[model samples]
Target: MTQKRLTPTQFRNQLLAVMDKKHHWAWPQFAGSAISKAQLKIHFQQEYGVYVRDFPVLLARIHGTNPPMDVRRKLAENIFEEDTGKLSLGKSHPELFLTMMAGLGFQNGAFGNLTLLPASRRYRTWLDQATLNRIWLVGTAVMTIFVEGSINDRQELLHPSKARSKREIESHIKRHPLVRFHGLSPAYMDLSRAHQLVENGHRHDAYDMVVNHTTTRQDQETILTALRKSLRLWLVYRDGIARACRLTP
Candidate 1:
């Protein structure tokens, strides 16, 4: 079937529609604490190798290509927070993640030299290429909307969360898997705390940066194609990790 030309709003909806399927079959196993501690380490190791550590650098790649000034400001804010934590929690996100891991008895050295699973390697390679795309918006779409945003993105974009109070944040951390299942202290949940401080803005910025900037149908098609490709690789990546962790998917 031939494709129809769509208004920008229609095109944006299609991009978001693709995000609605980002959830993997094995997600519940991970989230529900069905995986054991050693298996959980594999999960976190793969995640750090895949995107957690280099996220700010990916945003910097887009910023380097010189997007519009307002867009640059948004990128700058996100990069600043992830790289510096000056805006939210006073430490970089990756650092906070390691701190959280410490609470679970994870050694900092364990994450130092990770060999990504085969599927994870392929997915990371795709991320490196997408962020390097000549049309900066394509890089922006993959990095921000597709990578950063989650399956809950559709709901998040439509009904952004109000900033939570301190008590609420503490309550949320008490229920975290690390805290509940692995005996991690809520004191080490600064990564989650920083996210609650800034996540809503990030979600809006992710969509608005792509949707507002993409005008031509060809760019729209290009972006949507890249996102669909990302989704497929990501699922396979999750499958690889699930198998390594011995989860039935």
Candidate 2:
């Protein structure tokens, strides 16, 4: 008998386990009262330069590739939301992030002229290379699984010990230290709004795309290899931001 391959859920869970470990770098600082406004500016500036500015294009790369109609439809929905925000919170996610940056006291047009640090530049280069040059599966995994799937409510400052309702999470997020401690207005939190609106079931969609398309053993191995490489590069990227923020880790 032929050897049994791992099921899609198993593969997805394994990948997510590794990805979760990589989040230990700066999330605590970011999601808590630890990060200052100045630190947030450094973090946002690097984030805009390295990835935020180009995320729509990354999703579009996967969309442009000849994926199945079902997958393409999902990718197109995401790209449309990223580029136009018609389906989400009514503003492009990147522009909303810049709005949050403005609330952080970064002047207008600051995000457009960002000077990327070395590790930040390397991460961007890898992102461009992976999304623009690699297979559709690789591109999808990089943009969706690696980038978008990084955050969760459980990691935040107001993380409830018990399972909280969506309304409660939103309430806590509205009073989050990033807004309350930094003195940023809640009106500029479109990024957070957009996320809460469309983030449901996203990781499942990402894994479904990969596991449904990657039929062969070789293809599965390729995705694993690419995600592993992306994770290493992502750690360096976070390290760069953490150092810039002067957080000793």
lDDT of each: 0.89, 0.77
lDDT of 2 at 152: 48
Candidate 1 lDDT over residue span 86-112, tens digit each? 988899999999998888899899899
lDDT of 1: 0.89
Task: For each candidate, give its TM-score against the true structure.
Answer: 0.96, 0.88
lDDT of 2 by residue, 1-249 (tens): 644666776676666665766665677788777677778788888988888888898888878877889889889888889888888777888888878877777875777778999999998998888887557888888777877766442232124244446686578667877776777777777787777677666666776788788776666777888888888888888898898888986
Model 2 scores what on Cα lDDT?
A: 0.77
Best candidate, TM-score-wise?
A: 1
- Span of 10 residues, lowest total lDDT, candidate 1: 1-10
Q: What is the lDDT of residue 150 in candidate 1?
A: 87
